[model samples]
Target: MCRWLAYSGEPLRASAVLLDATHSLVAQSLDSPMGAETVNGDGFGVGWYPEGAVAGSIPAVFHSVEPAWNDENVRELSRSIESPLFFSHVRAAAGPPIQRTNCHPFRWENWLFMHNGFLAEFAKVKRDLTFAIDPSLYPHVTGTTDSEVLFHLAITHGLADDPVAALTAAVDQVERVGRDQGVLFPMQGTIAVTDGATIWALRYSSQGRSRTLFHSRDVPTIREMYPEAERLSQFGDHAQLVVSEPLNDLPGLFIEVPESTIAILDREGYHHEPFRSAA
Candidate 1:
């Protein structure tokens, strides 16, 4: 398992969510109360679109196998850079070796992706899933984790055009392959992806018990709900976050994304729709 967050709206220091929150991603990396694993020390990565960049520009990436809490580079970069959209992930490797190549927040073109779960009995279906990816995208998969494979799978199915539909199709294929190989409850996970503008997150499992996920309530609502909380003052009206768990314990600040749901967050705001497999 792993923990990750996606932010959209208002260009601000990445550290606002990655390092400065009450229970920030760095804090979660060390003591995650809601993640499947408490210590996600395997590796970490951050991907963010540069300010004022044109459409289709690939995000800047920083990856390290060091624990997020101990990584000075992560802290420095988070404080120095600001972007309207970005992703941060601290991984707990289920099987893949801990290495920069196996880090989360994988990128392709203008898109960034990360996952916090596994393909049950992946070895049984790895071949089927690997071969299913479109040949053109196959060569671009550089890591050996199911997460990276899933990203490419989504790309093969048209993630760049329709992220929700493509991810649904990708999950459907993984489950179908796992079932074919006799693995029960084949998929389990929460996923976050962005194209430097809009963010799409999913919480689902074949058995209907997905990992935890939540998105912040709108800034205006949060300010009114926690008027005395000083942290609320730091965020702009457009600030929004979708995470594997709540960044802070402040009541009503974050809304739990329903199981089997796909959440979408953009400049317009956030909404969720029921997720269904294409297969």
Candidate 2:
């Protein structure tokens, strides 16, 4: 399992959420109270669309094989860069080797994708899944992790045209392939994808129990609740976050995303819909 956070809204330093929060993404990397593994030190990555960039611009990514908390560069980069939309992920290698390529926030063209789950018995169905990817995308499958394969599969299934539908189809394919190989629970995890303007997050599992996922309460509502909390002043009304877990314990600061649901965050704010495999 892994832990990740996606931020969309105001242009703020990545460090505001990555390092400055009470239970920041970096903090989660070392001591995640809600993650399956308390320590997710296998590797880490961050991707962000530059503030003021034109629409559809490709986001920048920084990846490392070092544990996030131990990496000086992660600290420097997060503190220096500010983005209106960004993604940060800390990895806990389940079976894949620790390497830069295996880190989350995988990018293709102008879209970025990350996942906090795994495909069960990946080795058994890896070949089938790999062959299923459109050949044009198969060339970009640089990493061996099931997460990367899942991203490309979504693209092959039409992520650019319709993310929710594409994701559902991709999961269906994974479950169908895994069950064919005799694996009962074929998939499990939460996922987030963005194209610099909007973010789409999904929480689902083949067995019905998915990993924890959350999104921040709207900034205006939080400010009204904690009138004197200085921290709430940093974000604008539209600011929102979808994370693997709540960044802090503050009541009403975050809302848990229901299981088998897809949370879509855009200019209008957060909207959720039922999400299940098409199979």
Candidate 3:
């Protein structure tokens, strides 16, 4: 398993959450209390839409096959860049080889996708799953990880038109294929996807117990709860975050997203709904 986070709201330096927090994504990479693996040092990646990006503009990505905590470039770049929406992920390479191409926040056109879970027995169903991708999109499948294939599968299933539906379909395909091959638990993990404007985060697993996930409570709500917490002043009323785990120990600061649920964040704020795959 890996760890990831998605941010959507006011423009802010990526480092604010990726490095500056008490349990920032970088910190989680070094020592994650809730992750299946404590150290996710295989590699890391960041994808962000520039602060003033025009509509339909694609996000930029920086990937490195280096432990995030040891990568000087991760700190430098994150501090310099401000984005209204972004994604950061640290990998633990369950079975795939560590390489730049295998990093998270995989991009296609204006959309970015990242996963914190895996498809069980991927090798058994890798061929079937890969072949199921549309030929036009299949060529872009440059990595061997199941995460990348899952992203493309979502695109093939209509991610651009309807992300929640597309993701459900993608999971269904993976489970159907895996079960056919005799894997009882075909899928397990949390996923986040964004198109520079809206973010959709999902927590699900074939066994009904997915990895942990949480979204920040609205900024105004947090400020009201802790009137003297000056740190909360930096955020605007609309600022929100969905992460693999809470960034800090501040009580009521984060709300755990329910299992088998999809959390959607946009200008309207977070909305969650039950998520189920046909399989």
Candidate 4:
């Protein structure tokens, strides 16, 4: 239940999409054609936003409990750190506990988040959504995943003023405590977030069958429909990507993020709202 990718355009090198795409993101942690596990080796993370900080601060994470395809310090720090905002994940430990703070894009203060899905009955609705988080963001939820307690319950219900209504109020507080303890389809995958200047992705679940997600159909309109694929002339003019699949296999390059959407990329270009409570 893990596979993630998020970026905010034009700085390149995080292996040009987390390891030179052709299904990269470290080759989908070893072949994940839309994961429910096809070898997400259970521990990986990468977070960026460090190229002269000091604006709002906080964005420089690099976790590993090994197995981001055998991390050699995540391939020498994703080819020597370059950023325009980033987030990466590759773990499939369904219920949690693999270590390294449950490896993900979870951070705060300049935001960053990640989740692939599953909160369904997280040990009986995880103590009523962890005592309804907000005791000053409850010691920054140092890990014990229900995807980092749904990213600190969307930073205590207000991810800097409406991140899809703070993630639909953390899925309406986990569907009002997993439907009074019956827990039908509580929630499922696909969530990505950022604050190093706008980026948010979400697809939904609650049994509407949500899983696979994709994006990246704008890189100058696939560089004028593959104008001789010069690696699509190195991304800019609002480069975009929201991946959970399709890193390459051209033919009009990637789309399909429906079923309760939210996808909004920055630097202007790419929108798709309507997951406002499944509309």
Candidate maximizing lDDT: 2
Report, for every candidate in turn, its global Cα lDDT versus the true structure.
0.91, 0.94, 0.93, 0.82
lDDT of 1 by residue, 193-246 (tens): 988888999999999899999999999998888889887777889999999889
Candidate 2 residue lDDT tens string, 1-279: 899999999898999999999999999999998989999999999999999999889899999999999999999999999999999999999999998999989999999999998999999999999999999999898888999999999999999999999999999999999999999999999999998999999999999989999999989889888898998788888999999999976888899999999999999999999997866
- Report the lDDT tens digits of candidate 3 across residue range 1-279: 899999888888889899998899999999998999999999999999988899889899999999999999999999998988999999999999999999998999999999998999999999999999999998899989999999999999999999999999999999999999999999999999988889999999999989999999988889889999887766778889999999987988999999999999999999999998898
lDDT of 4: 0.82
Pitting candidate 3 against candidate 4, the one with the higher TM-score is 3
Give the candidate order by descending lDDT: 2, 3, 1, 4
Model 3 segments beyond 4 Å from truth?
none
lDDT of 2 at 192: 97
For residue 210, what is the lDDT in candidate 2?
95
Pairs that collide, model 3? none
* Residue-by-residue lDDT tens digits, candidate 4, 1-279: 888888777777787878887788888888896677788888889888876665577898888888887888888889897877788888888767889988998888888889887888799989888888888888888888887888888888888888889998888778768878998888887898878888889998878788898887877667878889888777776777788887787866888899779888877867889885531
CA error at residue 210 for candidate 4, angstroms: 1.8
